[model samples]
Target: MNERDVPGWKNCDTMSGTTAGTTAVGTSGTQALDTREPGAGFGEMTRRWRDLTGESVPLPAFSAGTRAGLRGRFQATRLSDTLVVDFAADSAFRTAGTPVAGEDVVRLWIVRRGQWALGNSRTDNETTVSAGGFMLRHVGRLTHFATPPRTVAQVFVLPRTLMRERTVTGPAGTAELRLLVAHARMVRRTLSGLGPAGVEAARGTLLELARAVAGRRFDDQEPLLASPLAQAAKDLAAARLSDPDLSAAGLARELRVSLRTLQRAFSAQGESVTGHLREQRLEAARAALLTAAPGWSIADVAAHWQFADASHFSRAFRARYALTPTEYLRQQRELRAR
Candidate 1:
């Protein structure tokens, strides 16, 4: 749809489809995309955000010299299908994003580092978002937001193809939406510390959170877990390495696939259910030994990976790494110290 047809067709620049003019100068793969430059990088920031969201983002003169001395960075990382972006503008600036076309996505905008002067084009109403407050923006609407100098904000853009559209100002179930938004913010904030632990579970949980925030009345949360069921099952098992209650049957039940279906999936990969669990457990345990906290006892490591005891964990670790768990941790620590 065009800008005027959008729900809150703000008097902002109409966002078009992805622009092909900007260069890809940030991190490759799924790490993060950042724009860091001298003076105002408004043009670059706009392009970088467009590349991630596949929408046009235009910049407005919000500072005395927004097109001159504006300096800062914008960073974006992809987790599963979601795009998490953090933008810091050292200069005062405004973002006039045109209404996103043909996509019914929702962007969770969290004001993490600055105060924002937000404008709604549809109602000609303006609001302020201080630090720690967040709002949701429908992709198919006009967008206008301005920040004073030295501002930072984060956006968690999630596709909402699975849920009904909610109005920007008056979505139903406000309390539930608040809880889900807070949970999503926390996930993106501490994801690095999680160190790949429970990534699959986290991804699945995010799907649920997004649906909840979108005010969907469905019980199934798999609109985004469209990956191979077998691989998804394996990821779930890996995420639960420390739970001790994760088993083939439990995994099947959790993943909503029958035990027979799971068995058939494993057979297709030429692996037994037993062998798959062992390898996942062993790999998780080994990874933990490498980066685990200093005070983590051997038993702690073992229990985290669901091993029966320290001896079993050590034996399994040695079998895979050709070194005892203690030896591996010590050697790695000494190397780091050196």
Candidate 2:
């Protein structure tokens, strides 16, 4: 297929002669899943996926009675700054981020088959969504989702700039998700068929659709942050863990409240906003260190969480956990070995 034929992508190349090899960020066309045979080189494809998306997607464990291998046939097409990809996996797996950079894709997925149990960063909660469903995630957020065998999903990897500019993005509440999933399927279909210019022209519609999924309620209004202002503040702090400018004052501005009001709110909950944000950042860095990949460095994790530097991050971590980041990571590795 020619370059113009593929939507949202240019200069496409495939690592294989056929559908089963490592495909690049663009697709030739909608490639079908190769259920006839187990896909080869799952490890390489998954690593490429890591490079493409800046996510560390761990390979799934094989379930009883299910065969293994990368049965996932995923194809990508870039539309302007956004990437529209379709994934169909024959085995169940979980995915999470190990960010080299602080930013994560704000992915909007339309579930066509099977189910996914999504984990949230702001809270210790999992939302199980199935076919005819959609999920909207924030930048830098971590999630774990399991795919059933023969599962098919269409995902729109939206640009964070578009989200930050056109919409007030946040977590999707249960009440609004049903409405969103229905609307996204329609939008996903419309996007799939559109050419580059057509896709560009429809940017307004897509942004509105995304805004709906992220923050809007069933009434199509942006859902108000849950009360008990301290909790809401904490949630925002956790969500924006990587932003260096995410101070108490900035948090107040985002919340549209005065700085004093924001401080007072957190004080009511027995903590200061500034203190809380600092702790959240330190904690985020600590967690990142525990799961840091082989090639990652202490400096990378520090910068990712917007810490002053490696030394500052280390000091804070050691103060909190009584162990340096390296020591803590070593302990975690030893614990896993047992």
Candidate 3:
């Protein structure tokens, strides 16, 4: 089976050196790969699958019908810095568990129809995601997945750099996980109608929700008893901290709440909105300083995290951690060198 075998192929391959026949779905970096055709063999399907998803599915040693029985589609949409893939299938398949080069993505698989059998190669642990449940996996690691027939799911592919943890595993039905699933479904359902700004906001919301579920915390400073609206506002702020224009009023507008209402939500927790945002930015800048790459500087961290200037960032850093940004970076380097 080749490109000619599948109808309506749109050539959605965005990566370099992509073959010319496959097609995409949306205008803004959305790619959809289909293999629902009865005549489309597994070899072609698996090749396109690997191309689009960075995962490889080889023919099983014992199965002769694997080629003819496989049929599914992977629809991936790029949202700002992240990716969300919705998949549906009518057959069972297992991945080779090989790592893809230069792919630094963490996946949150939300199972809406069937179950997923996941194996962590490092720990030799097996986890299952049943219907209405989800599992988180870092694509950089070697992890095996066995998806049975009739499985329908959505995969939220978040950048590893955007996450604080490499991988975290836990039971399903966590409140954060539930919110993430609902939020993702809502974004995808209303995706087309959302213009540029709306798309950006949606991206931030989804990323925030995914991070909450994966990192196992919404905001470290957010009081456990904080109101739901306050927690949500924190999530949004954390997501858009890189924006220099982010403010309490902007947050209130995005959250569809009055400014006073939003302030009261934070006030009830004994915190002010502006103060909380500053704390979040300072913490984020500190994290960046600690993880500073080669050629990275304090000024870069300051500007990226939306500080007015290096001096202001230094003052804030000293106030929070009792050490200037340069001192903190040097201390972290010394510790790593040891």
Q: Provide the overall lDDT of each model, using Cα atoms, as 2-decimal numbers.
A: 0.55, 0.54, 0.64
Expressed as tens digits, the lDDT of each residue in 107-220 for candidate 2 is 676677886665542133366557776666653434445577767777666767545423232333333343333333333445445554455544444455456456563222
> What ranking emerges by lDDT with the best candidate at the front?
3, 1, 2
TM-score of 3: 0.47
Candidate 3 wrong stretches, greater than 4 Å: 1-39, 42-68, 73-75, 120-125, 141-143, 164-166, 170-172, 215-338
lDDT of 1 by residue, 172-265 (tens): 2243343344444445544554433344455566667656545533233243322234555665665676776888898767655567766776
Model 2, C-alpha of 183: deviation from truth (Å): 10
- How does model 2 score by TM-score? 0.39
Q: What is the alpha-carbon lDDT for the whole of candidate 1?
A: 0.55
Candidate 1 displacement at residue 34 in angstroms: 11
Which stretches of model 1 miss by more than 4 angstroms? 1-55, 65-71, 75-107, 110-117, 121-134, 139-143, 146-165, 168-213, 217-284, 287-297, 303-306, 319-323, 326-338
Root-mean-square deviation (CA) per prediction: 11.6, 20.3, 19.7
lDDT of 3 by residue, 186-256 (tens): 55556566666666666666667777777775553333313555766776787799997899999777655
Report the number of the highest-TM-score candidate. Answer: 3
Of the pair 2 and 3, which is ahead by lDDT?
3
- Candidate 1: Cα lDDT at 79: 49
Scored against the true structure, residue 223 in model 2 reaches a CA lDDT of: 24
Q: Candidate 2: worst 10 consecutive residues by lDDT?
A: 17-26
* Per-model TM-score on C-alpha atoms: 0.46, 0.39, 0.47
